[model samples]
Target: MESSSNFTPFLLFLSATLTVLSSVSANSEGDALYALKRSFSDPDNVLQSWDPTLVSPCTWFHVTCNQNNRVTRLDLGNSNLSGHLVPELEKLEHLQYLELYKNNIQGVIPPELGNLKNLVSLDLYNNNISGIIPPSLGNLKNLVFLRLNDNRLTGPIPKELVGPPNLKVVDVSNNDLCGTIPTTGPFEHIPLNNFENNPRLEGPELLGLVPYATNCS
Candidate 1:
């Protein structure tokens, strides 16, 4: 009888521990996003609703959450937001879509974005963003659509972003990207026109030839 009572206390403690851990995990993501909100210059007051004191970021504008209240999407496209992206965004572990297209947001792609293993679509096209595509983005095995077109980005396309298992669409066109195009994995199926307008970018690299390291810098 005493052992049974002890077991009940243990069970309660374990449950409480799990609950606290889950809450902390969810809050961590919220904190990361709030950091992003603080980094931007929101000309449209689009991010004014992002109050950190909220129980969760699910209540914020341009943010979406899963059934578990974990952040899953951020739809801030065309919001006229400027300023650089924060590396703190890497904390959004469950993020699937990051849509910041058509904004004036400028700066380099955060290599920490590779930490978002659950990402599906990444659309930052039509912005003034510059800097080389991070090789770390290759870690997003779940990535499907990657559109960074019409930017001021320079340097060779990182070969790391070529072979995501679910990739379907990639449009880096109209950028200042250099080096030979990757012709492996998902790259083999992307249409040539999608890569058009990059003056220095070369071939869907040939069969046996050693592809450019794309690290010309």
Candidate 2:
């Protein structure tokens, strides 16, 4: 058998290869974040630390990462940010908390957000976001807190939202939403006040009495 010393060169090469791969993964995540930074109008420079030159976005403020340097939480709430969210946000495969509440963020919520299977809390309240709530959000089975209240959103709440078994709190009040409020599954425990202020929203969905989609248009 060959001496152990013969493996030294092979081991060194393997180590270098791994280092390069780790750098590449970090850069990919950094790129996705930079895309978000570019899309926002940060007058307060809250995203100044989100430099693409860095090896990883973990160094950026408002971003939290795991032991493996994968992004998990983004706390940019109340940062005085405007502009819409980017679809590239779906690239954060390990992301859990996405807090962008109390901002001036406009435009529709990206449907790509539904791809974050590990997500738990998604707070986008008090923004100017409009458009129908994406049905794709039902894909997040791990979700718990979902607050989209105080926006300009229209259309019925997607029925697929009931799929998340861990969902505890959901607020969609103060919006332009129509359709009967869902009463099954996770929506059973939701407070009536949470569903208040929606002038067009019909009361709880009565089973077998009328279609839930009635006059929802």
Candidate 3:
């Protein structure tokens, strides 16, 4: 009779331990999402709808989650969010879609964004962001869509950006960027509009045909 009583207590203890471990794992994932949420400055309260107090980010509007309940998509396009791209966003390791197009965000693209290895689509077009495109973005091997058009960015387009094998759409028009456009990968098939409005840019065809003081060859 005494052995049965001891066995019952042991089973109860094991069950409690398993429950606590599951809760901790869920809390850890939630904390990671909360940290990224705190990075952005939502002036117009577009992201005000994102409440971390909720059980999971999956329940938040505009945020999509996977079967594991991890944040996978953040579509905030045309929401009028005005702020700098925060490096802390790298915390969302499972993020696949990050759409922030047609906003008023300013400042340089954060290099830390390269940490998102699973990212597939990153659209940040029609913003007022400036500065050079970070070469570190080449780390996203699964990226298919990347749009950075209609911004005030300057400097050379990183040749490293052409390394993504799955890259399909890349629009970087209407920027202040200068220098030669990459002649490899998806760049070779890109339309002329992709390189338009950048006064100092020299396309592949004009690289050797044009005669100028800059020596584009």
Candidate 4:
């Protein structure tokens, strides 16, 4: 029964709210990426385009975004970068492909990376990374390829990795990993060579013959 003009103010308020939300989302994503830029030693200025003053990381080089301006991929492989990864990377909720392979990056793989539920491929091979494979990575139900070979990592591969239903490929060889290889799930079809070369890692376990925990001790 009221006049239609009365709705104008409410509609304007709603529009402004949405704009603010979009800006905040963009800025937060930018901040998270900028934090990473600060953590790395980029000799080639491959990250020169990562200006934190920008409205969105979508405009940055090596960063891919979806139609909604949400980060989807980060391709910084082989860029001569050397530094640890930042935990802030978990903020990219829509991230899928995280490729930082064949670099000189050191330090542990941030456990927070497991929070990226949409992640598909995680390639950190041929780096200087050293740490346990985070069990938290089991949360990535959408993961497909995970390559962490040729690093200095030392620990048993978390059994949780065996849970991702879509995981088709995994290579953790040439590390210092200790323990029997997981025989279930995606590992069942994976080539044995993919898990070889770790001096302490053993088994495609013989059921009832060699227990799964035989080597870790």
Per lDDT, the best of the predicted structures is 2
RMSD of candidates 1 onward, in order: 1.7, 1.8, 4.8, 1.6
What are the per-residue Cα lDDT tens digits for candidate 3 across 47-164? 6666767666677778898876777888989986777777767867889999999988899999988999999999999999999889888889999999999999888778788898
Number of colliding residue pairs in each model? 0, 0, 0, 0
lDDT of 2 by residue, 62-172 (tens): 999998898999999999999999999998989999999999999999999999999999999999999989999999999999999999999998999989999999999
Cα misplacement distance, residue 32 of candidate 1 (Å): 0.8
Q: Over all chains combined, what TM-score does candidate 1 have?
A: 0.94
Question: RMSD of candidate 4 to the true fold?
Answer: 1.6
Clash number for candidate 4: 0
RMSD of 2: 1.8
Cα deviation in Å at residue 55, candidate 1?
3.0
Per-residue lDDT of candidate 4, residues 1-217 (tens digit): 3666888888999999988888888888899999999999999999999999889999999999998898999999989999999999999999999999999999999999999999999999999999899999999999999999999988788889899999999999889888788888888899989988889988776664666555664
Clashing pairs in 4: none
Candidate 4, overall lDDT?
0.91
**What would the TM-scores of all predictions be?**
0.94, 0.93, 0.80, 0.94
- Model 2 residue 138 CA deviation (Å) reads 0.3
Ranking by TM-score: 4, 1, 2, 3
- TM-score-best of 2 and 3: 2
Regions of candidate 3 where Cα sits further than 4 Å from its true position: 1-44, 205-217
Model 2 earns a TM-score of 0.93
Error of 4 at 124 (Å): 0.5
Query: What TM-score does candidate 4 get on C-alpha atoms?
Result: 0.94
